[model samples]
Target: MKEVTPTDSEEHVRRRVSEKCSVDESPRFSRQQSFGRDIGHAAAETYLVTRLSFNLLGYLGLGYQWITRLLALACYAMLLMPGFLQVAYLYFFSPQVKRSIVYGDQPRNRLDLYLPPTSDGLKPVVIFVTGGAWIIGYKAWGSLLGLQLAERDIIVACLDYRNFPQGTISDMVGDVSHGISFVCKNISAFGGDPNRIYLMGQSAGAHISSCALIEQAIKESRGESISWSVSQIKAYFGLSGGYNLFKLVEHFHNRGLYRSIFLSIMEGKGSLEKFSPGVRLKDPRVKKAASLLHHIVLFHGSADYSIPPEASKTFADALRAVEVKTDIIIYEGKSHTDLFLQDPLRGGKDELFDHIVSMIHAEDSDALTKDAVAPERKRLVPEFLLKLAGKVSPF
Candidate 1:
């Protein structure tokens, strides 16, 4: 072969990076000008269309509130049975769906707990935040997650945080923070180990859960009941979750549904600096506190359709950048919700406690007791981490 030239070496490097990104090529000087123009035009069209739709919706929201309410009520009345049927599937099809609690002021948006039978001692705990793209969701999402943890002898709680139409993402986080504090404080009463609670959520729930860890809710009453340790949180497991609202809005082009759904999440309070996880990293505390190394766990599906894999990938890279201890599980062929509900896990569905058992046993060697880590369950920690150290050393 002829001697490789400097130009050839540069071309090879560019190609390698392009392949890694799964794009034909990086936006480079070599790209034709027409390509940029075409992309700009497409983006402009999308923006204009979305802006018009949002403008129209603003009018409808302001001028037709009662009309819309009546229509919505009529629809709900017609679909009440279907709604109930959907709930039945959630209860029967999903093992994690457990009981609800009337803990919040509104009562409708209250907390719920799901705990497995455990001995008198304290066991690990996992707090679940459900996802409804920030608009609609319920406390039952955490039930399935809680039951799994219970089977592993680790307690689980599915919280009911304030939702949109009445709260922002910041407000939701505040609600969750209180919810977390409430649930943790009462774990002992519910037969749980308050010291070992982990904050977990999916999608929008994950976003607010992240906010809860980073930002303290507007000065809440702190008491002995609110005592918690980040170390004890162990980690955050975000399944196709953790969408940076700023980037998410950009990713979806500020469309009507996207805006209504997302803006409603934050009470129209989203700021670039406040909403994006990547941007938030610029803050000293976020950079210092963020990482699987500290007390966060990240889970994402490589082929997720609801949210891009890059959502987790972006946060994962950030965690790695800080040398924080974070673990990510990318279900190679799984989608967004698959990682949550019982689906084809390793090709077959399992009992309600499958994921919880895996997560707890994952660190069995580091656990106080193998039986306690998961008791009779299997390990959920990464295989490499498990094999790297033959013994358990959680610290």
Candidate 2:
């Protein structure tokens, strides 16, 4: 029997074959990954389209009017897709973003927190409730605002709650209040200052949060045992919100929100005055409760058709009538989404962003000085796209 020894060339040939086999498999593996991603993306798009379609049908019914608005909305979204995608990526993957943190026991009772880079001091907190009419409301809607504020050393808690169909107006209010209580009690663990917590909401969120704030105040005035105190909130900021459901119901109906759907979200016409912050404050019994409310600042766009600037104006006047300090700022020619979306996407020194930051940092001279010299934010969407989006926006 003879033993054979392999030569170096033979061994080299064997290794080369192994390397070739590995190389051939690599592309297949990469292709599989790519295919999986494509499938996931397709599924997400289908889900979103289906959900949006169902919501539209439920809220506006089957009509040419809604179909036309949907087309416009689709065009608007596509035009702003570049900015939306970037923010979505950051929202889902950024280390600074802590998503789906539970604040209550109910389903959808979750919130997302945007943490600043440095935890040097207890930073001011903004508990933000996002808007989505009533059916599509979700906390992720505030990702852009949360990320921007977090960059300025602010802690942002974007609260998620049960939307219409899942729950009614009262449920949404309760969820927001519960979320606020959680943040007020636990935000310190995340480097948020308890005393300087500010409450903020946009559109429907503004209405919901306002209701929660008012309800809490009324409870406190009545000596009801509460999980959170109105005194704990430093201020309330309502952005393009409707406060008087009594006034807004018909307006919303004409604007495509529809009377039936609007009434249902509001728990019917009978409950409209009960949920209306402006109307509720006019009552003498709630005057003491209103007095306990912190400063309120309302921001609305003059050209906003979703909810008119007068909604904010009338609410501010109501707050003043009860001796509560209130202020309303209106941006001329700005649409419903312009101040919140387009301006932020166009990115430099945003007037609304600056106004909010300035107020939040009012007590901190050093922060104000830093902000004064802070570099302008990089633009996400092109000017042309933003203009097109504005024209096509259904909101």
lDDT for model 2, on a 0 to 1 scale? 0.86
lDDT per residue for candidate 2 within 46-163, as digits (tens), equals 6854776576566566866657877898899999999999998887657688766667788678788899988798999999999988877878889999999999989999998987
Model 1 lDDT tens row, 166-269? 45666677677766665655556555666566778888788877777655311121212333434546666776775466667645433234545455545564
Q: Which 10-residue window of candidate 1 scores lowest in summed lDDT?
A: 386-395
All candidates' lDDT scores? Answer: 0.55, 0.86
Reference-based TM-score of each model: 0.62, 0.87
Backbone clash count, each prediction separately: 23, 0
Q: Candidate 2: TM-score?
A: 0.87
Error of 1 at 116 (Å): 1.6
Give the poorly placed runs of model 1, Cα more than 4 Å off: 1-98, 102-109, 118-120, 216-229, 253-256, 285-293, 342-356, 362-395
The regions of model 2 sitting more than 4 angstroms off are 1-60
Against the true structure, whose lDDT is highest? Answer: 2
Clashes by residue pair, model 2: none
Highest-scoring model, TM-score: 2
